[model samples]
Target: QQQVKQSPQSLIVQKGGISIINCAYENTAFDYFPWYQQFPGKGPALLIAIRPDVSEKKEGRFTISFNKSAKQFSLHIMDSQPGDSATYFCAASKRTDYKLSFGAGTTVTVRA
Candidate 1:
């Protein structure tokens, strides 16, 4: 069962454009929010994350925007490139709990 809901099952973006993925959760107990990026024949890797305390967190071209009151969060990929193509998953979990509930995932294709 997935506690998180994500939109746009897939998307195509041109190189140097921005790709945005949105996710929402109903569980208020969730304190840890992370976005995972997975490539073919590879496991998902943690891209970026943000907690309830912060409205946003940015690292390089990847950014995580969080809204505590709405229980929603988003991932913004800047300067999309062919190498950035992958399946992205939004996940949420409590700090004390090791288990995570993930969204269906969005496949992003960056066109050169």
Candidate 2:
């Protein structure tokens, strides 16, 4: 399945709050995991990524918690802010081919 269903589909968060998004997939053949962040009319940027080999991965203010057995993953935004407002997408691919299977999209709005 090339589709990645992400929910709430959209989100609203206050400044300094935590924002969470979840995703699931059916392709066990996929191994690479990458979470992308996008602003209006812009290409998605890689926020964080992990492999099924690892249970979790984190960056500065971004975190990706993955569960291989469940074929699911989630993104956690710590101390969210207005600047963090954007769309997020969780993707899976085989290797470093640069080809990505994307979620519909998730829009996050952070208010002050």
Candidate 3:
């Protein structure tokens, strides 16, 4: 039940379009949800995160919508740009857990 499942292994979007990725978890014990973005040769960087208490959270062009009852969460990129093209991963972890349960990454490409 510590698994985070993500959808759409790949996505292609036009510049200025919206990019969306979805994830679901089966573990109710998870309390922290975070999204990570990784470039070609760099480590994954934390993009945005949300707690189970928050229904939604937004930062710049990135937004996270969480559903506690459904055990699902999603990420939305508004006005997607070429620079936004990257591999994104959704992860869940509990405060007591030392590691995070990660979803299969979604590779997004934003074409101009």
Clashing residue pairs in all predictions, respectively, total 0, 0, 0
Query: For model 2, how does the per-residue alpha-carbon lDDT over 1-112 read when each residue is reduced to its tens digit?
Result: 4566788789999999999999998888889989989999898898888999989888989999998888999999999989999999998888956678988888999999
Candidate 1 lDDT tens digits, 40-86: 99999998888899999999999999998888999999999999999
- Predicted model with the maximum lDDT: 3
Give each model a TM-score.
Answer: 0.98, 0.93, 0.97
Model 1 residue 19 CA deviation in Å:
0.2
Superior by lDDT: candidate 2 or candidate 3: 3
- Model 3 has an lDDT value of 0.96
In model 1, the clashing pairs are: none
lDDT of 3 by residue, 1-112 (tens): 4399998899999999999999999989999999999999999999999999889999999999999999999999999999999999999999888999999999999999
TM-score result, candidate 2: 0.93
Clashes of 2: 0
